[model samples]
Target chain A: MRSPHPLRARPIVIGVAEACLRCVVCCAVETHFCHVQFEEGFDERYTYVYHCLSAPDPASNPGIWLCTACHKCEEACPYETSPLRFIEAAKAEAYKRGLAPRLLTGIIAQITSTGYLFPITPSTMRRRAELGLKPLTTEAAEELRQIALKTGLAEPRGEP
Target chain B: MRRYAFFPGCFIRVRLPHLEALSRRILGELGVKLVDVENFTCCPEAVSLSVDKMSWRVMAARNLSLAEELGLDILTLCNGCLYTLRTVNQELKGDEELRGRVNDALSIIDREFRGLIEVRHFAEILIENLEKLKAHVERPLEGLRIACHTGCHILSPPEIMGFDDPYDPVILDELVEALGAEAVDYDLKTLCCGWTLSTYGSREASERLLASKLNSMRRGGATAIAVICPQCFHQFDVGQASAARRLGVEYRLPVFYYLELLALAMGFSLDEVGYRYHRVRNREVERALEVAG
Candidate 1:
């Protein structure tokens, strides 16, 4: 499943190829420390280089999986390569291929169905009423549903 | 007094209405009129964008269109919402092709994102009117010590966010001090809140990261943690106990949304601001109010 957007399907790769080859900030935990530690014996540095070289091919690259989108690499890059943006584009590609994490997919479904990341449950309405806040109007929900349908994102796979 | 449309994103509306209520009260008192922008959806958070960028962009564009229809700039309470709306606003404004695509989808609902308005975080607005904010302080929070957590969305990708120096954000600290409190400096002040990773199956790493930050705040003698984002508030407030349990340490740091602190300093009572609703007991905040009275 390729990206519906022409620009997204083939993002304009920014910066020189040699710049990424010379820069090692994207993989260095010391340069931009991630909260998620790598598993034992998994050489983060080697894995990072492997992924960085596989640019525009997220399926083959492991760096996209390692990046936390912390934007540290972008900040730390002396050559202004914006490595994080490349990683993000790769993630977008992965998402198009139905490779997004389950937790994220669940969130997308909820947003599509309810117009909120979290469900506006009965108790939520009760709390809002108690606090004198108005409920989410039906008109707004319909607008969101239309947006989702037009984007072909949250449609119930087979049912239109 | 500048009037702006208020976009209270999902978290504050659903999980923490008190933050919204107190923000309205505080902003009103400061002479900034907050008009409710009805029928607003999620800023369609970055996480959602990662899953489906086009859908996220269209949803965000729709929200921006609502603000443009009212001919008012959006004032957001959540950092994530500010990031999403502002980034999308810039993207749509700069890319004619992308804007055309998004507008085409929006046309189905009789809406078009003209890219006419700007999006701002509530803290940015407060900082802009610091003189007025300081003038309205009836009871300065003189001796209170607070650690300001600006969170990642409002500060990162500095070119897009354009809020403060991302590396050393003092905007939140300045706001805290305006209320007569000491903005305690701590290490990891600029680190991610780890909320995103926590949700994505890195629970241990998230807890460890949070515990480290809490430990730093404790070392700095901060009585409470001040946050501008509801998500960060949840991490420090609701997630603190679990983090402490995981790390085998005690972290009793009470989390206060920046507006709550401002509301209190500007003469609103504890009950008026809904401090009791906080998960971790804000004994220090309670004591500060009692002493001020």
Candidate 2:
């Protein structure tokens, strides 16, 4: 599916991760936009993530793949720091460190290979026709293929 | 009537074309003409951010440039597409350095990032023309209780999306009520659908997130779920079946693209709105249509 831009997208703003979202109550993790938080009981992981962020490379924290990029924590943060930017930067940094999960690299590979997230099968095209929609084609697909090659996507470090 | 360069994102155009068909019909009814732009690509997708930010902007600008060339703003159906395209458009329009770099990358393809056009999400457009939209409601949905999932990308990081209130949204609810259906209030009303994680992260987490949302909707007395984004629709529709099998709870909540609901209100039958394509069918929706229509 879709992946984030960068854990820290330097283009948008470098050092986004530097703005530590130290919620006075560590509520971002507790109020995380997922069921997994409640399922695993994350009141304590808030402390763990706080300590984890204090580490040398906070992006190396395992399970960056799980962030939905919802940015609700950023909305709810009392510290007024953008927690979404921190998570995004951490995710990108993980990729640069080559520790990106298979999914990130795999999706880029799919896009570079097919100019789409999923390879459009004949059946998919037939389905569009069945719905009386236009064929899903774009001339810029060659451009996407070229840009992926020229820019050199972040290489995967190892299994996610 | 206004016109926009239509950017039907890959997910709906390929996987769920019914939404596209219904959206185009409904948008036309609301007095907007969607001009098809052939060269537009993936909103390169928001997730592409994790892999490469530079490429994400370049590709997004490439898609925007095609619409800009035609002198029309871009209209998108999916919120992810709105996120990628609108953010890139807003970023490129204000920043000269980033635009320079992205233009350099685009030079290879003979495309330039002029950043002239605005990117629009359908909810805002439909909401803007609510009066016209109201006139088209041939069959008012009285019995249906819709739990509206506005989805994140359509309204978040408010400065960029610039649509509804990111934290507490009511446009979908207003639209639902405009159609005479009850928009039920739920606890997880504005939570992420967790489809992104389910795709490449943790299926268990995604399924759990979905179940909680479904359970919340059920408690709110929701008979069906309404979504504006294709990803949310898939999660609520197909994800219901997956969560049911694993969690062993039949959260039989049928999902509708908000536009599909609009189409139904415009007196299109369930078959005409493609309800059969929904993964989890609810008799309440069908019964509401039969008894009320």
Candidate 3:
């Protein structure tokens, strides 16, 4: 079942995939064996990542792979390529194929429900008052919800 | 004195309001005028990017557009927000194709990212006015030993971040020293605070990473850890107790937001910077102030 979400359906650019094939710094860092893996000739890691990226079945790919979104790989890449962009694209594709982490889906659900990642409980409101910050107005919250709905990132409240 | 639109990202505003309050008070004292930009949303954070890059870019662009409309550069207090907004600004400015797509999406909300504004981390603003900052220090933190945590986002992807050398960042250290404190050098100075990993279901690895970094700071003789990012500050301050429990060692390292340290050097009282709210006691900071006197 393909996701009906707009962002889920967005195409992964071919250029980004080609760049990842050329430089697999992101995959190396995610595995945390960059030093040893590179010393033994990174060709093996590169081929493995290429297959994961080009794989037809998301389930066939290694489930151990995870990008912490640290962007260290992008920083460390000698070629100045943004390996993170490619990693993001791959993750988005995986998400569409129902292979992304379940925790991520929970986060999205929270955002959709509250228009914020975390709930603004009474204690939160009291804390804001103590710090001299004005409360998040109802209108502002509505505007945020509108943006989320317009972007197809979230559906209207109380709708499936 | 340049004017800037202050972007106090969600975590700082919601979880660490004291940091936000101190930043405003200290920046005003340091001759930077902070204009509050309203109707701003999240930088959408990096997690969103991994799940949906286009949506993340659009939301970030919306925030950037708010600053542009105000005709002031943005001053971000959180490193995560700094990375998201700055990277979006760079991408939109450099890539006409992506910008068009993002702008089209933004049009629904009646916003357009013209790419006219610059996104700056608070550390960059301090470094830019280092001399003036030094001149305003009435109470020098002379004997204080600080471990500076630049956090990952402020200096990473050096090409796009352009704030400092990613491998060996010294801007935060320099700022710490200018206030008459010793910025202690330690291993793992550039590692992530493990906050992201902790949230993403790698709790054990994250706790271990924090334990190692805190142990290093303690061994390096740091009295307190100075951070510009709230997430890193949380790891050392509120997260320290749990970390100590997990590692079976005591870590009493007090964490201070850069603004709190500066507020002290500029002669603000402990209550003024909300030091009492910190999870770890501010005894070391109090002692440093007493010794400086």
Model 2 ranges off by over 4 Å: A1-41, A44-56, A154-160
lDDT of 1 by residue, A64-124 (tens): 5545455666676667776656656766656656666665667877776666777777877
DockQ of 3: 0.26
lDDT of 2 at A158: 54
Best prediction by TM-score: 2
Model 1: per-residue lDDT, tens digit, B1-293?
78898998989888888777778877887788899977888788785565467888999999999989999999999988988899899999999999999999999999999989999888888898899889988898877889888887887688899888876889999999988899998876777777765676456766877887888888888988999999999989878878877777777788889988888887888878887787777666678766865
Model 1: how far residue B289 lies from native, Å: 3.5
Rank order (by TM-score, best first) = 2, 1, 3
For B237-284, candidate 2 gives per-residue lDDT tens digits of 888888899999988888889988888888888899988888899785
lDDT tens readout by residue for model 3, B134-159:
99898899988888988777776677
- Model 1 stretches with alpha carbons more than 4 Å out: A1-33, A37-70, A155-160, B282-285
How much is B111 displaced in model 1, in angstroms?
Answer: 1.1
How accurate locally, in lDDT, is each candidate?
0.76, 0.76, 0.72
Q: How would you encode candidate 3's per-residue C-alpha lDDT over A32-132 as one tens digit per residue?
A: 22211221223544533454445554332432134456666555555555545655666666565556565666666555445455556788788889888
Ranking by lDDT: 2, 1, 3
